[model samples]
Target chain A: MSQPGPDAPSQPLRITVLTDGDTRPPGLERIEAEADVVLAHDEASLRKALPGSQVLLVTDFRTAALEAAWDAADSLAWIHAASAGVDQLMFDALVESDIPVTNAQGIFDRNIAEYVLGMILAFAKDTKQNVRYQQDRRWVHRDTETIEHKQALVVGAGSIGRRIGTLCRAVGMDVVGVARREKPGDETFSAIHAQSDLDTLLPAADYVIIAAPLTDDTQGLFDAGRFKAMSPHARLINIGRGPIVVTDDLVAALDAGEIAGAALDVFETEPLPADHALWGYDNVLISAHMAGDFVGWRDALIEQFAANLARWQRGETLFNPVSKRFGYAPSSQ
Target chain B: MSQPGPDAPSQPLRITVLTDGDTRPPGLERIEAEADVVLAHDEASLRKALPGSQVLLVTDFRTAALEAAWDAADSLAWIHAASAGVDQLMFDALVESDIPVTNAQGIFDRNIAEYVLGMILAFAKDTKQNVRYQQDRRWVHRDTETIEHKQALVVGAGSIGRRIGTLCRAVGMDVVGVARREKPGDETFSAIHAQSDLDTLLPAADYVIIAAPLTDDTQGLFDAGRFKAMSPHARLINIGRGPIVVTDDLVAALDAGEIAGAALDVFETEPLPADHALWGYDNVLISAHMAGDFVGWRDALIEQFAANLARWQRGETLFNPVSKRFGYAPSSQ
Candidate 1:
């Protein structure tokens, strides 16, 4: 285990990055200036690189190769996930290990919030129908619903959820937040309820946004029963982990017209197979797990990782340290 | 001429409503209880009904029947337009007449603002692409732009433009307003500029929103030259009048990719003739002129007109009185 006190390391730290080779963080040369850097793509490369590496940077958060190579990581002291959700990287070996895990948290909050707001507005304004009418060269004048004074129940009380609530409030929405723990109401949320209240809150929501992490408690949280509880006119937007929503149950709910529509950025199986029935639903909007990704995000992630690297070099506590037990970085607030 | 003083009329006023036979204000029975109500859908009916009517309510503001039958309007004292823009009704005979024209201005302001925000968010988050990908059943991950900290220039300092600016500001955008006359800065706009500044402001805007009235000064304002002045990445949104943008020039600019895209609600022609080339553009989002028409808008319009009618009956000053010379209701502010 690495010591916690402020003592400079005697030698250069070994940093191994796991990515699909399409995008490694830009400005990585800044980190390479001090450390010995290695890029690995698959299980074989990761296994070969994991031994004797002091720090592992999971740029490709989707890969579970790290878990398979955990026994080979003899000198790994820390892991940094270049993503807000670190569920894929949270294997039993990692949770049981003494290594500290950090995630890119604050970086994606406002971007994801904007994405959620966009989806809400898209549903309210019926933009999908507008596109359809345009495609057919048919000019149909239709009345649209206003989102103002409408109820939005955000299913997470983390930074991203709070930011989503704040943006929604700016547009005159009545925002309610549901979290694992009860929290006092703030400018963003009119009220914050415990997870136990989700069943009660779901029916009242015109928009339900999921920004919660995928923990054991949250896995399959939004199943058939919860979908059945939501208003028929309500929309579901999930930017969180995909498994949190039972895909088969969601399809059934959507098929039954239990809800108006949904915008799913993440999926249970990403690169969501081409033959998936979810794609066939006109009411269901599908995007490739990129709600939080903005142009230049790679540069920003590199900057964040460099800052954390500097802290690690100084033996100081890292920012956005994730709680292995909770499966997310606990909110600093 | 109707006298302007605080004295109730001895006789009930005769009201004629011009509509397209599709929608009439809901709960209009309340108004019918006090006045002699006549509904007319065409020039023949309008001309026959106009002679003895004390008030003419233009529910279908797109009609020019009022102007054509103006000589037959012997007892028409007040004209109420159930629309913000009175351009169509601002014919020579009506504008030169002493009859006071009142419009449903406040009713559309916030709703149109919401529509503009929805468009801005749609452009930023690329919701259009999301739909296309969903249709194709392809899950391709890509980075999206953020609306926060982006610059939006709204061309019109009226209530609608101010409302749009306020909503944009609430979502962390920097808003600039342009109008015919200069005004002091407000919470919504950082600064208000003269229409002359539009040339200078166009380049700096990431989003250019047209909310100005259709007048001699504004008609064809966004020609090919003006489109060229905008950034390649900037998007144009017109919720105002379609003639304000030269349709052919807009098509040329769009084809040339001079601007990123556009969301055009009101077009130069109604129902935008099916074979028009504008409908073929993937980048353009076309919606029928229904931005301000929310679910209960007709009811709201009736309520506004009813209040104005009560004032007219009491011989009191009316709300939303248009400036004949300017072609829109003069803002009381």
Candidate 2:
């Protein structure tokens, strides 16, 4: 693999975008005015477009066509994903290549943080049961718990988790963050503990929010044992990668009443099957994998990509560079 | 009515409580130890207990038995309501009498503030629809709006409305409060507008929260003309008295899609009848009037009363004294 020189290219750069059908990024006109744009949705289209493109914009991170067409990516110098996690693109072929990869990280932090706060307040106020009563036209007056002064244990200490901690603290909650390493606390968290302290923290937490990335150390981290360690009244919220939680163990925990409730936005499988037992639990709140999505997100992603493109043209380092081995953008970036 | 001297009472003070059956305030034993306590549920019981009683505590605000038996209240010197609004106790007899009225004001401020935040976040996140889709086990992903930097118009300047504004500001919202008189802006609100400015404010607000008391000027304030002046995408939340909004006009506005959605915790009628049309609207969220109720709210109310009882024994003015002519506790009290 040869690196591009700092000198400007003699011709316009060719940028190819891989997206699902009908998933065009907004504000592409800003990028199109300065580059040759090619939109590809399938393996055949991607392979044909990959041969001449110098930059690849993976708008649909779920597609595996990138791995299949890597052999034809002769002119590809940089890859940018329109998602926070680059796990799908970290296959053996790309990992061995020299092309630098960047991701859209900071854009989703506040949006996901707001979503988690909504779930916490919803659980504390019994909003799900309220809606159910509304549907049945039942006037049921019940007491609800308060989140003020309540403890929250965030399992991840990344940007997203920090934002969640900040929002929770703003509402008078006591926040503790768990990361792979113990560190000095910031304004958002009172203390950051090592993962080994999860068992100790679980009992004190009224809410356990998962915002950790999917890595070898985190897969299946929340099993029956961990659930059993938590307080019976504590709730679990997963806004991170789905594989970090064992779905079956969570169902068992709910069935046995080991925990009060859960709100799951992601699953081990995409579009969790219609027969999934998790959906049948009255205490569980489910949402499609959209915790970080907001209206006009596509336009925001395009703007971020365009800014990075300008830096690339000047041979400056990209903004949110991801380490292939780590599977996520480092917090420092 | 003879004015009591500033000296301690020579005899035990007679304290009568008006509450629904099986609804005694929590921690009443502490008060019972010092005073002669009488509990009354209906008009006959209230009349039997009112004679020679110096103080009345109205825990059930819906009761009109007090008005029916006002003639028997020969020795009643003061009345304390376990609610923020004193409309139920604001009969002509009490308003024109020498007896002073007080209410539970500060107790419900934080609780109601949290509830309003829950509703705002729920609407912005589309949480009610999320639960519906969850029940059907359908994973349909959709974009949701964000509440950050959104404009909120709170139509009250009381403790509860102020707290709501503070919490909304904590989550990055721009808050504008409406009161009868304009005041210097506090940290919670950017500006406090007079009632006359609502028409101009309504057009720009993304969320309009009603927390005003049930007063002559506020009754039927949110009618068809006001609703028409609001943006089509704005949402309305009512945690205040029900009569402040015309129920029929609200229904018509919602049916016509003039507003995006609403979350109504108060209604023109309590225990909103099962056949009510408001229950059928998919865009509206309905809850029983328990927004300010937390797990131990009864105990908190009793504690507040006990503190005020000490001041009464000393023949001093009570806390939270209401303006009988105004039908609510004035902010200064």
The candidates' DockQ values read 0.88, 0.84
lDDT of 1 by residue, B148-238 (tens): 8999999988889988999999999999999998788888899999998788889999999999999988999999999999999999999
Quick one: best DockQ, which candidate?
1
Q: Quote model 1's TM-score.
A: 0.97
Candidate 2 has a TM-score of 0.97
Candidate 1 pairs with clashing backbones: none
Candidate 1, residue A201: the lDDT equals 89
Candidate 2 ranges beyond 4 A from true positions: A5-8, B1-8
Worst 10 residues of 1 chain B by lDDT: B1-10
lDDT of 2 by residue, A1-333 (tens): 334523537756888999986767889899999799999987899989887688899998678889887787878889999988777798888888888899998889888999999999999899999999998999999988888999989999988899899999998999999998888898989999998888888998899999998888788999999999999999999999888999999999999999999999988998889998998988999999998999988899999999999999889989998888777787861
What does the lDDT come to for candidate 1? Answer: 0.88
Top of the candidates by TM-score: 1
Off by over 4 Å in 1: A1-8, B1-12
Which ten residues in a row are the worst by lDDT in model 2 chain B? B1-10
